[model samples]
Target: MPATFLHRFVLSIGFLSLFHSAYSAAQHRSYLRLNELDFTHLPLDIIIQALISLFVIMYGVMNVAGDFKEIKASAELENKSWETFRNIPSFYTFSHRGKFLAFPHQTGNKKHN
Candidate 1:
């Protein structure tokens, strides 16, 4: 699914709604504090607005992010060539015990028996 103007618009709207609800909650708390009242819970309307906005944001994100590919190996390697799987130089190590075995006398680490 290609991301269209509508998707971006909806995402922006959702973020705006969420921020507005947060501001409203903060203002409500300040008002209660000024009146020496205990902070209980947020108003129903603010909570509802926040929940709706979350859903809207999720919907917008899902539509904007295109489809996901399959995780199967067959699907991943279907169009790949053998050259892609060839020896990668980054993984090759030149300094190892194998080199000493290939040239024992040159290494000057001979064992006396």
Candidate 2:
């Protein structure tokens, strides 16, 4: 993912190809020449394999993106649920008549109905 790593990878591939070409040239190998190869005669399985690989990569990227979306949605729902719970008053703090107490005192400190 880092630019420097990508640059190194590209350079490595280029160097490897250059070395291979030089080695093949020095060997006088006529069969290893690229100019004599047919460009339009690829096998069916090669094309199928390439297509399947592309689909798999796309599926993986989309799967990760979908997971991020689901996580964000779940976090938002949790926040909203907590907010709703906090906005509602609990029974311990509820007001009755003109006073706010959990219950009347047993020592006759409060007037009973």
Candidate 3:
């Protein structure tokens, strides 16, 4: 779905609220430092404001992104040609453990009986 005016408005409000909360926390910390007070927990109201703003931002973003399409493997490969599945020579590997069974005597390691 296209991003409506309401969505943009909500997103803007959320961002503003989040910024305000962050600024308020910073100011609170500064105030405590100026008075030489111990650093303690943030006020409940600021925490609540931040959480609510985060939820609002999430809601606004989901609405603005539009609906997701269903993905199907069969549908994806439907138009592909058979020639695309053919083996490529550059990808071939001739070096493997099978060579040991085929030419054990040729190997330098002697068997201990």
Scored by TM-score, the top model is 1
Instruction: For residues 14-103, write the lDDT of model 1, one tens digit per residue.
Output: 999999999999999999999999999999999999999999999988888889788886998888888987958899887778865674
lDDT of 3 by residue, 26-101 (tens): 9999999999999879999999999999999999988888886658768766887888668668888899778778
Model 2, span 9-76: residue lDDT tens:
54455445545545544443444354575444435554454455455545444443344445565756
**lDDT score for residue 97 of model 2:** 62
Model 2 bad stretches (over 4 Å):
1-35, 67-113
Better of 2 and 3 by TM-score: 3
- Clashes per prediction? 0, 0, 1
> What lDDT does each candidate get?
0.90, 0.50, 0.89
Question: Candidate 1, after superposition: displacement of residue 71 in Å?
Answer: 4.5
Ranking of all candidate structures by their TM-score, best first: 1, 3, 2
Error of 2 at 54 (Å): 0.9
Q: What is the lDDT of residue 52 in candidate 3?
A: 99
